[model samples]
Target: MVEIAAWLRARQAEGTLRELVDLDHLGHGRVRLADTEGPALLDFSSNDYLALSEHPALIAAATEALQRYGTGAGAARLMSGNFPVHQELERAVAALKGQEAALLFGSGYSANVGIIAALMGRDDVIFTDRLNHASIYDGCRLAGAGIARFRHNDLNHLEELLASQPVKGTRLIVVESVYSMDGDRAPLHELVALKERYGCLLMVDEAHATGVFGANGGGVIEEAGVASGVDLAMGTFGKALGSYGAYVAASRRMIDFLVNRARSFIFSTALPPAVAAASLAAVQLIQQEPGLRQELHQRVALFKGYLRQAGFAGDLGPSQIIPLRLGSSATAVAAAERLRAHGLFVPAVRPPTVPEGTARLRLSITRHLGEAELAAAAAALVACCLR
Candidate 1:
């Protein structure tokens, strides 16, 4: 207990102690701090890139399912909890990812960890990106396999590790299609070639890219024309889809194997029928409305252009996520406060969310915000962090 307290004190000294803030959503990219009737602040910290969470289509689907199916699934999926909406959503996900089959999990983190644990085992060696999500690392630990972590997005480094490790068991390589924090995309073509050369299974976590890329929102894999080369396509409905749950799209055999072997899926209750239905609606909506993705990119371009014009060239990527590293936790927190002072509520992302010296504010471009809001956010960022 003393050690725990000391650790917390250390975090406090570093200005990294975390706390949750209650917020009231005001729609159209505005939020107010709850309990005090605070002024509406431009919400630039949400992951709802396409802002479909509050769409009428999604809401109506969820409402219908709720009225028909009640509140919960009542049991684990392997038992009696599975609903028709589950299968329907899985089919939609499989089609979206261009795979023969798919299986749903409670969340993106669970899907990732469960997928890794079920596939690679004691004799296997998995090569993963150094900066891959924590769930991937947890999955590696659960699998009890030989783990090789290469530098983030460095194919040469990954190849070096792959070549050095002697061939043994089922070799797998995992990476995110679009990094959650950095927002940079993976080199799918090169990774596919390397996978072919090494005879390794390749998995791409398309959580961030799923609803924001490709003509039909199939993510970076489809955008790069390497969907067939990827062995497993993992993604979530919670982000741009604006619903809850995650899924993995793969061959029929692989998904069947997960159905039988993935412990997370086997042990957890199925997602509520309404959430699954909402997710299905979100998927169909994204496919039918390509304008949503296009409009989001236009917002990205507009915001990034503003930053460029303001002469702040730290870390601006093509995707919706952007970071402005401030090197100190206190500095990042101060920046967030300054932005909030200007009626923009971008959160300060400090360690351990980022590296020790890479603390910054993560700004997510969403369709909820209009051109006026985007311009105001850009101006605030420049005033808060740049100058």
Candidate 2:
């Protein structure tokens, strides 16, 4: 006990330790129910971008699946738990993304780790964006690939780093289509050109872009018309899909390779049948309801407009996830508290999730929020900025 306590104390002394905040008092969206807090705050923080978290259709699908197949898969897909729901989801996701095949994982976090590590290894060279999701970074590390990080979204830096290397062994370039933190997008066209020039494979994490972009809601790869160009595209059902699962859309060969090689996929239990059913329903809904995307786009535009009109000071980008940069973690935390005090919920994203000195409030907008809600949240944000 003394030894463990000493180790924990060391981390706290170095300012790298974290203590999870109690969410018992939190409400939905960005507002959490803290024990010390009063009143329900307006939520602007949830990753449920489509507001499908509580959608009746999704809920019904999940309930049906649970009734039909029970709550758990009971085994890995390759083993006894290969349910019909999983097969249906794989096929549905493949068709939705216009890919040859799709493989399901427990979560986007595991999908990225499992797929990347399985595909690339010690001999591979993985070029990554600095702002890519931590799952990507971990995947690269797990693969034991030599990693080279370029500046965030800087193709020139990427090219320069690639050029400096005399031998490119199994080159893999990784990036997020829409960075989760800054809410900015990747230059897919330029990335395609670079990949073509270097003869490298590209892996895109569309976790944030799924259900938010594309004519059919496939994500940035489809939105940019690079679905066929990218070697692998991964996304999460947890976000806009309003469920819990992750998938990799790729060629049949790649899918098969992951099936045999990805340790996480092999060892972990398959996603619950209910979640898979709900995800399949979510996929169908995304395609059938183009209005959802349209409305979300309108909300994004409206939020940005409100910021511009109010002259709110922050890095408000094109994506739905807007970063209200406060520059310091302490200040960001304080501002979040201030917003919460006004019945507005916004979490302060501190270091590790974001780079140092760039701690901010990550505000995500969705179509579920009406114009009045948007305006009110924006006004509150602006007031917080002013303070």
Candidate whose lDDT is highest: 1
TM-score of each: 0.98, 0.94
Between which residue pairs do clashes occur in model 2? 25-33, 26-32, 26-33, 30-43, 30-44, 30-45
Residues 1-387, model 2: lDDT tens digits:
469888889766644456775665332344457666467667777778888877889999999888988899999998998998898999988887889999999999999999889988877899999999999999999999899999999999999988886664689999999999888999998998999898889998999999999999988888889887888888999999989999998999999999999999999999999999999999999999988888889988988888777777556787899887878777887788788777777778888888988888888887666787788878887877655
TM-score of 1: 0.98
The candidate 1 region of ten consecutive residues with least summed lDDT is 309-318
lDDT, each prediction:
0.91, 0.86
Residue 342 error for model 2, in Å? 1.0
lDDT tens per residue, model 1, 149-253: 999899999999989998989999999999887788888999999999999999999999999999899999888888899999999999999999999999999
Give the poorly placed runs of model 2, Cα more than 4 Å off: 1-17, 24-37, 313-315
Cα error, candidate 2, residue 165 (Å): 1.7
Candidate 1 — which residues are off by over 4 angstroms? none
